[model samples]
Target: MEHSIFVMCILAVLSIALANPIFQDFSQLKAVENANKVLQLVDQEVLSNHKLGQQSSLPQKIDWREKGYVTNVKDQGQCASCWAFASAATMEGQLFNKTNNLITLSEQNLLDCAKSYNDKGCAGGWMSHAFKYIRDNGIEADGTYPYTATKQECSFNEANSVGTLQNYVKLTKTTEEEILKAVANHGPVGVYVYMSSLFMGYKSGIFEDDSCTETPNHAVTVVGYVNTPQDQYWIIKNSFSKSWGEDGYMRMKMNKNVCGITYRLYYPIV
Candidate 1:
């Protein structure tokens, strides 16, 4: 009976793993033309014209999670608020590094208040624009404003703000080395990437979807990186809840410009 119970426990764990959507096979997942319409709102000209500084040297391995800058994974639900989440996460890291206090900021604040900067809230938005809003008006704490995962009227109150950005700097486009240096020296970075069907179903291992396009449609935070002799990858923190890839995180193949991860990366200066 004891042996049988052990087998049953193992089976239960396997059952739970199989039930996760990320485990589903995506071999037949077709690439959709409009799969990334939300990212089309980004003003490429502004990003391109932005000046970049010299690259700093980066360590072979760095993890912000171990350094205590990363916040808990968040769930955006059905909202296309990846841009807001990414912006807030990067700010949280910067704030923590500055004050040694890890406070969760409100993505809803950006969703509602940053529309003046051309953000469409849950419909779609740009991280660069969100940073501009934060720099100008400041961002409230999650406890003050909170995330509703839906479009709401602006209820911004600067008095309740927990963080503010002095400025934001864009990294050199298509330069993976520069991006690595930025993440290593700074805390986390806000970056855009193509959200392919395979990416949606990613569970584990280094994600290197060849079907991914250069068009970035979703924003996420790059918290760290790993360099193995065989494979190198970027540690990405997603806002899709802890149930997704490696507890709402993903590692994509590094230095290949996978899914335009290196195209437009920016970080806040607090």
Candidate 2:
């Protein structure tokens, strides 16, 4: 009787094991995990509202003088100052577009000083939190200070803060062209994109596919836009080390919310 009971238990365990779901690869598993976030944005109502068509591409002949400036991020190495570098670049572009003179804000300052929101300096951070920091404490000029990607002592004088938080304009819900026109006409726009793996260290090309063949990791800035006859693209500047691609600059397809720009809830400094 005891032997019969043991055999029945083994059979039940084998049945359970065979019934479990088997995932082929990390991509499929990730898809399952990200499904909620995807549907939240890609649903019919939201997708139809974006009007993702009318946006322009990164012009083939990039007239830097007329379009705007494209700059690089000082190599931050393995540090987590990516958030600081990204935030500073967006703000820097905005300031540059407005004054017509480049301003290198202190990425080091944000890395060292911004501690309230659990931001791990070079580790990672959210654009919204970075903006909140700028709003609460005005940023300083690059000359007024310099960048130190590592967690260093905050030695800069507080009184040197240049612009106030009120200078930034936040957009709740708007179209891509509205944002691009804002950047072209007003200044740089701080956009939060769903960066995909293909975009990483991307050198040069007009991206069109959304296969997400790669995973989306960090966040970056849409400093400028371009409209080529072939395709529309966003001129993005990254905080990764210059060794990445084209000294940390790349072009992303404007189709299918490339980098998820359509769902972008952006803020800018006018």
Candidate 3:
């Protein structure tokens, strides 16, 4: 029940109009105090939500890229369209899961063509809306419709399409544990995070920000997770090019829903 109060208080603090004295006073201090709440509360063994009897069968770690289930991380350039990259990564994972052939889908197709589906081209977009687009219009191969990272004319050719979504899964009312389970069981999942100034300066290490506000400005893919004797974290594939983070990836500090990672998490079905 202590954890429950913390969660409730934190959520309440997020409100702009909440007149609670704690919200008005010592907000920054309170944020720091709750920084490691998830780390202290969550049992590391429940990382994958495995059944007790089947614990032995669970893999010690999971990184989809190591198994060829993930494609090379691509750059989104100056565009604020990491959402497209996140959605494409999720589709690529789902495609590989079905066909066993790793094929890169076209994020350009979504950028240029999916504006009607609630996409804003280089400005931004949502993964769920992109999935709806693939369901109705299908997605082309990256080779046929490569990413320019800028808004361009929609020249999508259905003949060159290689993947179509049968459906997509969006988990609601989720927690940090549920997000971890989704990444472990469902492969790479689409998740967004706040691109705080501190987060942008991330060079390496399990990234955790005590001052980060619960606001997500960028979308990325959760590739896998690991729990060692020393520490635990989630491996995330970013769209900021291979030079950023750990070769185009970030090992997000797990169990804290750092940067609102738990919200806007979804996976495509192909």
Candidate 4:
């Protein structure tokens, strides 16, 4: 009898732990499900608009040399440090454009080290959190500290790298209006918004609306925007484990009705 009671208690504890709202908030889940519905409607809208062929020319591609290349980081499983991935991608683009140096910086470094700033490397964080760290104390290249995909203590060194970053901008808000404006004016915008299981490992094609938005779980970059006759679409780059989707890219509808935007870029004051 005692053994049976203990076994039942263990199962009950596991069930409750799995049902915890922090791990999966029911309200947010409803929101994402609703957003997915909106996205599905947008899909039909896109099909109708496609009949026109090139309704909106691709927003002017940022002069790779002048502006910056918006890219995504490969998702690190359940590692919550999407904050590190987003932050490093932004820096990689800025550094490349400003110095023309194609150096893969260390997202793992931030993931492991940058903790004092309310960041839980693998647990996820806000883009602003990473940028603030950069502003307060700059960063280094992938060669400097390297990526380990594990958390550690930050050891920032200013002199170990070549060339400090310049002409980098971090947007204030993650609103669709703000992001579209930036995409229209600049080359590509880095953003960090919630993604659903459908978004996980997504490779190519347009992201159809799916009812799943409770947890904004991924980090991606907005490369371009289009105002189709039917609806607006954002050209996005994902960091899935592999290079998928239009050669490692995907399109997301800027459903103002659904909370989508996460981060934007503010042009550096030259």
TM-score of every model versus the real structure: 0.82, 0.64, 0.78, 0.64
Which of candidates 1 and 4 is the stronger one according to TM-score?
A: 1
Ranking by lDDT: 1, 3, 2, 4
lDDT tens string, model 2, 1-270? 544543343343344434543312122222222332322222121221322224354224332324444354576655545556667767766666667767678777777766674455654554556666777887787677776646766664679876545444444445676656655554445555543434532556765556543223245666666765666777666666665556666676654566555544444353
Q: Tell me the lDDT of model 3 at 69.
A: 80
RMSD per candidate (Å) reads 10.7, 11.6, 10.3, 11.9
* Candidate 4, residue 221: lDDT: 65
Candidate 3 on 39-150: residue-level lDDT in tens? 2322111122222122324454799898778999798776666778888999999889988999988899999998787677765666777888999988998999999978
Candidate 2 at 135: error in angstroms? 2.9
Across 1-270, the per-residue lDDT of candidate 1 in tens digits comes to 544543343343345436765523321111111222523454552443434445544577999999999999998877778889999999999899989999999999998999889888776777878999999999999998988878899999989988888778875365888787778777699888876656777788889987676456678899999976776999999887988899999999997888888768888888
Q: What is the lDDT of residue 77 in candidate 4?
A: 46
Q: What is candidate 3's TM-score against the reference? A: 0.78
Candidate 2 Cα misplacement greater than 4 A, ranges: 1-72, 170-175, 213-217
Residue pairs clashing, model 3? none
CA lDDT, candidate 2, residue 58: 27
Question: What shift in Å separates residue 11 of candidate 2 from its native position after superposition?
Answer: 34
Cα lDDT tens digits, model 4, 1-270, are 544543343343345436654323222322322232232211011111111112244443332323446443465444555556656665666566666665666676667556776666654555555655666666777778776656777776777543343334554344665565555654444675555434543556667545543333345666666676665667765654545566656667666523245433433211
Task: Please give the TM-score that candidate 4 achieves against the real structure.
Answer: 0.64
